[model samples]
Target: MPPTSPSRCRSDGVHLVLPIVERSSKEPSAHEPWYCIIFSHRLTSSPVESIQSTFSPLSGLINGIFFTVIQINTDVRSAAALLDQFYEKRRILIVSTPDISNQYYKLQNIMVQRAGCGLDLRQVTVIELLGLPPREVGRIKENRLSSEVIEELRQAMRISQAYFTMVLVDKQGMDRERYIDPVTSDELFSYIDTYMLSTEERERMENNRDHCD
Candidate 1:
């Protein structure tokens, strides 16, 4: 089979082509070996259109080949734009990042996605100390901050603090299944409520309620 033309290849999609080679025995009397080639691609389209287009070429390739794996990658900006085009007013954006700078960039993209026409930015929450290992978690619990990491964390926090309403969540006991332990959540929230507030800031925010109304 010939390679797919670049013009036919969709920009919003990926194309994968696998070639199969058959091995033959050294003896001239030996039969020729036959093998199967697999090709797969993921395209960005509406759910219905994606499904319909995916199977058409696949069906022509094999008589009874079963699809074992299918993976889809979506452009976050495009997805958000599509939602906005449909007049989605409010959206809950949950972004996770190992670095604070990436988190801020993701937040900015969300903001850009919802630009214009009464799209209010609400609920900007930040989760610090993400992806901490178990030993690191123990050290944090014991109030021993690594000097090197403390400086890094401080720098990250300084960069991200302005854009987000920061919340420090203790990531102890959080694994693949459980995101944050209930005890950790409670403790973190309590600490925030207790120490993260200035009386003047609180009063100012309370006074601004009339303006909001």
Candidate 2:
């Protein structure tokens, strides 16, 4: 049979082209190798060269086919603009590191994950900027921040992607604390209650704490 043509489709401003090579029934292993290519309008013609690749030795194949996720951000906001949304509403915890596997990053994640309720009551939002050159803006118990926002944040914070740094920004959009090492959730909560929270907020937090307990 003639080789199957590549199928093309577009959705939500994203363009995807999938090329499939059928495996022979008698000699499936001998079939020609094919690639699944994805084309995004936001990306250059050759995004594959830039997109990260992960291969699994156990499966002896790429874990997933090549496809650039279309992150839809209608109105991309600057770092300051993005952070402004949380001001007077939620305290921001910005964590920047070279990789997600960093010891301090993992420790911080565990600590935050354990104190979800406390963080919520304190109106704390954690933003993780993991990996550099093309850093990924992630959210802990919230929505992911866009790359544009992350880039602006990188500039605003003057973060050194080569090392681990965690900054605590209050609801007023001011950096209140900076940590080079992992901080305990209890320590974080104590600091926020002591310095960051208003009297009314503290009272509310106390009431919420009682119910949570």
User: Which predicted model would earn the best TM-score?
Assistant: 2
Computed on alpha carbons, the lDDT of every model, listed in order, comes to 0.27, 0.58
The residue ranges of model 1 lying beyond 4 angstroms of the native Cα positions read: 1-151, 154-195, 210-213
lDDT for 62 (candidate 2): 25
- TM-scores of all predicted structures: 0.18, 0.61
**Candidate 1: clashing pairs of residues:** none
Cα error of candidate 2 at position 66, Å: 47
Off by over 4 Å in 2: 1-75, 140-142
- Writing each residue's lDDT as its tens digit, candidate 1 over 1-213 gives 221231222221222322212243232111111111221222234323333344343334322322221111111223222223212111222222344455554454354333311111111122133223333210111123343443344343332322323323222211112121122333432343354435643453344323322
lDDT of 2 at 80: 72
**Superposition error at 80 for model 1 (Å):** 36
Could you give me the TM-score of model 1 versus the true structure? 0.18
Q: What lDDT tens digits, residue by residue, belong to model 2 across residues 1-213?
A: 212431222111122222234544332121222222222123333323332343221122223333322112213457776666566766778888888889988988788777765665676767788887654655432345567877778778777778889899987888899998999988988898999988877766665565334
Best by lDDT: 2
